[model samples]
Target: MADPTPLSVFDDLRAESDELDDAVAELGPERWALQTPASGWTVAHQIAHLAWTDHSALLAVTDEDGFRELVEKALAAPDSFVDEGAEEGARMPPAELLARWREGRTALDQALRAAPPGARIPWYGPPMSAASMATARLMETWAHGLDVADALGVTRPPTDRLRHIARLGFRTRDFAHVVHQVPVPADPFRVELAGPSGELWVFGPEDAPQRVTGPALDFCLLVTQRANRADLALRAEGPDADRWLDIAQAFAGPPGTGRPAKGDAR
Candidate 1:
């Protein structure tokens, strides 16, 4: 896989955001209010949550003290703060909500690009470099966009941009284990994914015994917890690679209770 610099990752961020914007723009009231696969979250909630986080990310990079204060206030509230914010934000007029999201993400992209070299930006979990932070934003947008797409019964065509998400999934292996309080694997796993554009994306040492190989899109969906491992065509060899597939989460935070198997309702 070709290395994606932070600057190149920003292009992916913009592209993903544009894709989501176009999707939401074609929706009407009924569709906007439709509940997504994420329990209790409507399509509106997903977009609202994306807008809210983009605004928050902008503040984190541009106004440290203010962002810190906001974070503190949010922490003082219940664990439902994020969800509550999304629910309330979703109540706005759809046009207004969409506009807010567009503006917020635009500002966030600017903030990230303009950040001084080597600057570390604070996040809910930890400070991240601009590239990592931008990739996280991409991952969130893609994951939430999947919810919206699923709610609409639409299939989002896979893209090579998924390389960023796949790389994040591999890079966050340790963080995933730590967040779940599972022992971090002493060994590393090799990830070899065929990108949507038919490019090969590889990670970890070539000699690693544990390996994951599959279509990049499937790997992205698996890591984001949007698709069940059993439903994907991904192949995992060795104990650690198989186990990681059971609990991989590209995003930071507690371990996610992943979606059920394809045919199961629960």
Candidate 2:
């Protein structure tokens, strides 16, 4: 699949955020306090993290120096910086947190839109284009939105927006292995997924010996570490591809302790 235009990605990012907002707009304080699957994180923390990241992204786009400060703080406490941001935001009243998220995301949108043509944005990972930054934001909003839904005992119907995530998961195939300290695959793997709307999404050459095929929802969940592999319907046709399924992570940073199968004790 071709890379989506930054404009389209920014639009989708807004829609994804709006959808998550609708899900929690009416939530009571008590519900916000409920813990999600992420350890030590409540439903509020999920939203807080999104808001915090959006703010950081804004800084990255419009104020590189400020963004670097955040980088220094993160480097100073690699293990605690993420949780620290989430924890600080999660401590606010539900109303305040929601307002901050909405406001911060709007500012980020404006900053990204105004970024000079051909300019690369500083990020936690390697510098990338504005479109890539937007895609990363969309990916995270959707993933954390899942945790919020689970906490609320509601199911978010799958949507074509997952295509962005599916593509990311495919492109990050090698990064996944490298992060795990495993050898990066010397050759690309072919990946085929059936999108939520029944569209075919194919990546890599058809003749590639390694292949992964599955429902797009399952692939996104696996790559995001939102669900256990044993619980997903994804199938792999090569040894390396199979191993990739075991450790595939679309996001940067340390690999997560993914969810356990339904049959396993938590």
Residue 197 displacement in candidate 2 (angstroms): 0.9
Please write out the lDDT profile of model 2 over residues 70-174, one tens digit for every residue.
Answer: 999999999999999999999999999999999999999888888888999988889988878888899999999999999999999999889988898998988
CA deviation > 4 Å runs, candidate 1: none
Candidate 1 overall lDDT versus native: 0.90
lDDT of 1 at 123: 84
TM-scores, each model vs. reference: 0.97, 0.98
**Span of 10 residues, lowest total lDDT, candidate 2:** 1-10
- Please state the error at residue 109 of candidate 2 in Å: 1.3
User: How much is 131 displaced in model 2, in angstroms?
Assistant: 0.8
| Candidate 2 deviant stretches above 4 angstroms | 1-3
In order, what lDDT does every prediction score? 0.90, 0.93
- Residue pairs clashing in model 1 are none
Best by TM-score: 2
Scored against the true structure, residue 10 in model 2 reaches a CA lDDT of 87
